[model samples]
Target chain A: AQSVTQPDIHITVSEGASLELRCNYSYGATPYLFWYVQSPGQGLQLLLKYFSGDTLVQGIKGFEAEFKRSQSSFNLRKPSVHWSDAAEYFCAVVFNQAGTALIFGKGTTLSVSS
Target chain B: DARVTQTPRHKVTEMGQEVTMRCQPILGHNTVFWYRQTMMQGLELLAYFRNRAPLDDSGMPKDRFSAEMPDATLATLKIQPSEPRDSAVYFCASGPGRTNGETQYFGPGTRLLVL
Candidate 1:
């Protein structure tokens, strides 16, 4: 079975500091990887996604994720953390045959400290 | 901006009651998906419809949970005899055909609490 793992349950970072959230997956092929962020009391928003070719993909809100086939990882990073960046981040992969749905990880709660 | 819309932002009902949630996808989107988010389960895809046709519903409990798209603009998820365990934030997402590496725009979500 395919599964996504986000090692950190919660992470705290100071404002203006660089941040990185780790994600690892178990799949036979190079799956369609995505990173979504959910603010408190809100729906998920796409931060970035990686399908092929590009190892580093940039997304909205100055977020970026790098896809590493060797490690089966797609990690999200931000150059500088903002208070608004405090949210739950989820890493997901496409597993279904039709490839319309997603299998999401348990997510990592990021806390920005001033 | 065109976005998916879900009705009844919050619903609190007693156990054994029937609960219905509605979603309206973006005008031209061809695929609609239902997902449940819980603290324990994270997020799970309950079902999805393509071109208003049912595709895979394996993630949903067939007995109590049912999903439907009565027409192009509306999609619904209903739970008969709702239970406390069914309490969670349900989200509806839609995209163009096949996803095509396209992003699935999610609605605000309907928060359900079964007492």
Candidate 2:
């Protein structure tokens, strides 16, 4: 079974500082990776996704992720952190060969300090 | 805005009661998914459908849980004799289906509490 690992349970960053959330997945084949953000009492919002090619994908709210096949990682990064970006972020993988269901990580909570 | 919508944003039920949660997928979306989120289980896929037909529901507890799409726009996840362990936020998502890199748009979850 394919699973996602988000090493950081919670991360605190000063406003305007750079932020990075690490994610690693265990999959035997080429992995389909994604990042999503959820605010309190809100639905999960797509941040970005990586299927193939380019290796780098840009997403909404100035977020981006790099897919490293060798490292088995797709880490979400933002050059500057905004207070609004403080939310729970999830990393997910699609293992469609087995089933079309998505497997998600435990999630990393981001806190921005002013 | 062509987004998924879930009804009864909040539901409180007693144990052993029947609970039904509903979802309206984005128009034109061919794939719909049901997911449950809790503090212990971050997010789990319970079931999914394509073109109003169930494709996979392996994540669901078959004995107590049932999922169905009565029509193209509606999907339902029902729990019979609900338990406290079932307390969680149930989410519905929709996608284009059968393609790589397809994004799933999630609805505001229905928060359920089984007391």
Candidate 3:
């Protein structure tokens, strides 16, 4: 079974500070990893995804995630935090088996402060 | 831009009532998925269809929940005899193909409150 784990339940960061959200996964093969963000009472927006090629993938809103194959981790990072970046972040893995959906983590709630 | 759309942005119903949530996938997407989100469960895939065929539904509760795709553009999820436990947000997503690694576009979701 493929599953994702987001270690932080909640994180607070000051504006302009660097941010890193940790995510680890368990999968049988080279997994398709994704990072998604959801605002309060809104649907999820894809931040970035890692399918193949380079380990570091860039996404919308200046977000990026690095896929570490050996460690089974795909952590999201931002150079500078903004108040608008406050949202819930989720880590998901797409299992390659048939009839499978993206398995998501419990999510990490980020609070940005000025 | 093409995006997934869901209907009944919000729904309030009593226990034992039936609730239906609808979704319209992107025009050319070939796969549709239904998911449930709650504080405890996070996001869970309830069911999914590939090319209008039921491919998987193992995550859904068989007794009260059902999902179907009547056409390429439409997918529906129905809950009969709704319970308070079923009070959560339902999301619909679609992807370009049935491949496992396909990127999915999600709908805004329908919030359901069962009293």
Candidate 4:
């Protein structure tokens, strides 16, 4: 079975500041990782995904995540966050087997302040 | 841009009532998925379909929950005698293919509240 852990439950950052949200996963083989964001009362939107290739993957709204196999982590990061970037972010991992489902973390709520 | 669409953006019903949520996937996507989101559970995949065939539904409660894709564009999740515990935001997602790794586009979701 695969599982995901997000260490931070809530984080607050000032506008234009750098931000990083930690995510760790437990899976047997190379895992397919993803980061998603959700606003209040809205469905989740995919921020980024990592299947293979480059360790650092860029995503929409100035978001990016790095896949660190050694650390079993796919932490989401942004160099400078805007006020509109505040939302709940979830990290998920998919098992490589057929007919597999994605296992998600508890999610981290980001609060951006000016 | 193509996107997934879900019906009944909000549903409020008493316990023991039948609740049905509908989803229309992207025109060319081959895989559709149903997920439930709650404060405690986050986002959990309740069921998945590929090529209009049920692939996995282990996350779904077998007794009261059922999911089906009668055709390529349509997917439905029905709950008979829905309980208060079943109240959550249900999301429908669609992906391009059945590969292990694919980015899924999600619908706005149906918020179900069972009183």
lDDT of 2 by residue, B36-85 (tens): 99999889999998888998898999999999999998999999989999
- The alpha-carbon lDDT assigned to residue A91 of candidate 3 equals 93
> Which stretch of 10 consecutive residues in model 3 chain A shows the poorest summed lDDT?
A92-101
Overall local distance difference test of candidate 4:
0.91
Candidate 1, residues B1-115, lDDT tens digits: the string is: 9989999999999999999999999999989999999998989999998999988899999999999999999999999989999999999999987555567889999999999
State the lDDT of candidate 3 residue by residue for B44-67, as single tens digits: 999998999988899999999999
Best by DockQ: 3
CA shift at A67, candidate 1, in angstroms? 0.4
Q: Which residue ranges in model 4 land beyond 4 Å of their true spot?
A: A97-100
Give DockQ per model, in order: 0.68, 0.69, 0.73, 0.70
Worst-scoring 10-residue span by lDDT in model 2 chain B: B95-104
lDDT of 2 by residue, A7-107 (tens): 99999999999999999998888777899999999999999998889999999999999999899999999999999999999999887754556889999
TM-score, chain A, candidate 2 = 0.96
Segments in model 1 whose C-alpha atoms lie over 4 Å from true places: A96-98, B98-101
Error of 2 at A55 (Å): 0.8
Model 2 CA deviation exceeding 4 Å by range: A97-99
* Span of 10 residues, lowest total lDDT, candidate 3 chain B: B96-105
True contacts kept of each: 0.64, 0.71, 0.73, 0.69
Interface RMSD to the true structure, each candidate? 1.7, 1.9, 1.5, 1.6
